[model samples]
Target: MTDSRATQADIAACVFDELKAIVANLPDVTGCAYERAPTDAQDLPCITMQTLDGAPVERRYLDGGRVANYRFALLLRKQDQEDQDRLDARALLERVASSLAEAHVELGASRAAWGMTLDTLPHRAEAGAGFADWRTELTLKYQTNR
Candidate 1:
């Protein structure tokens, strides 16, 4: 069994790649990019994932195999009219949620020892300045062999 903990960057990379793969099949999100941060240079729709927190939830063995609760945040950014952006963001987020319903597990080297699952109801936020901004978060739980 692996003895190392999965780092935040590792989780982010796995999620980013998985999200990008799913988004690629989305009809309306043809040009969107899966990014780690807002690239400001592009006004196109983009998605980002980040690790918020992690904690051991259960111990399965004496050697550090355990279930861990990892909170991950997904943010969607786009440029559009106030009302339109809100609706667009909602649609995009819904699509994303649907794609992730089965949950992404293992994710190459960032394997979740017991797979992954959505741990909480999604939370959403919206804002408008020159353009509208909308975001949502989903907490995911995965077993880790620390």
Candidate 2:
């Protein structure tokens, strides 16, 4: 019941912008931002992002999933992917994931409390071609005040 004729880059950009907007609204924490995606990395088959808390921020990824003709990208941006920044990472990921899911852009996304990761599989429209499914995931790690 949706149009999957969109390009991976377009979808990825959508996801990234959505994520940035959501993460920007986090509570208690500040200085939240997304890293400048590798200029050449865009050519890769995944969409990578990161969230900042205080000092160094953690990285997240959203790569392709299915194969050609039925391209699908499975993004995983869980706050638990890393170890050092796992505490606050959970909350950050939760807000981000929830906002993303609500947007319903790249199809659908999943969220959680401490952390959340989404995999919007490449979908096909009524009729299309020239595209492959891809997969990617990102984890947020945080420091605890405890």
Candidate 3:
């Protein structure tokens, strides 16, 4: 019989794809870029995903696997009025959190080989002169056996 276990990359890809799908469907999100930093040319109200670092989880069994982390940033254009920008950013931040919660349910139900948690960092309007960015990190723990 073929092995049904998952690898680190497989779990990472699954998480990324699921998150991308969820975020892309959110209101006002123009684009979702995978594994890349946002650039000036990217459409505003966009999200970017990049794979960060990972480490093996300490376990009593040799068949245990590693945990991978990914960084996700939501970018929006800063309006001329400060309050408007802040409100817009805050709404988007809430939407992102809600999306992550939905993703948790979706990912958990669909992928039986892995588990994920999301940690949202502070929101910042300092992503440059004209952009507000909200950042979050996703941690995924999955088996690496074959």
Q: Each candidate: how many clashes?
A: 0, 34, 0
- Residues 39-146, model 2: lDDT tens digits: 232232222353322322133334422221212223222222234334344434444455655564442333111333344322221111222212233322221110
Higher-TM-score candidate of 1 and 3? 1
lDDT of 1 by residue, 29-89 (tens): 5344443545463554666665665454545658765555545666666666667656767
Question: What's each prediction's TM-score?
Answer: 0.70, 0.33, 0.65
Clashing pairs in 3: none
Give the poorly placed runs of model 3, Cα more than 4 Å off.
Answer: 1-6, 63-81, 104-114
Computed on alpha carbons, the lDDT of every model, listed in order, comes to: 0.57, 0.34, 0.53
Quote the positional error of residue 6 for candidate 2 in Å. Answer: 8.4
Residue 86, candidate 3: Cα error in Å is 2.4
What TM-score does candidate 2 reach? 0.33
Greater-TM-score candidate between 1 and 2: 1
Candidate 1 overall lDDT versus native: 0.57
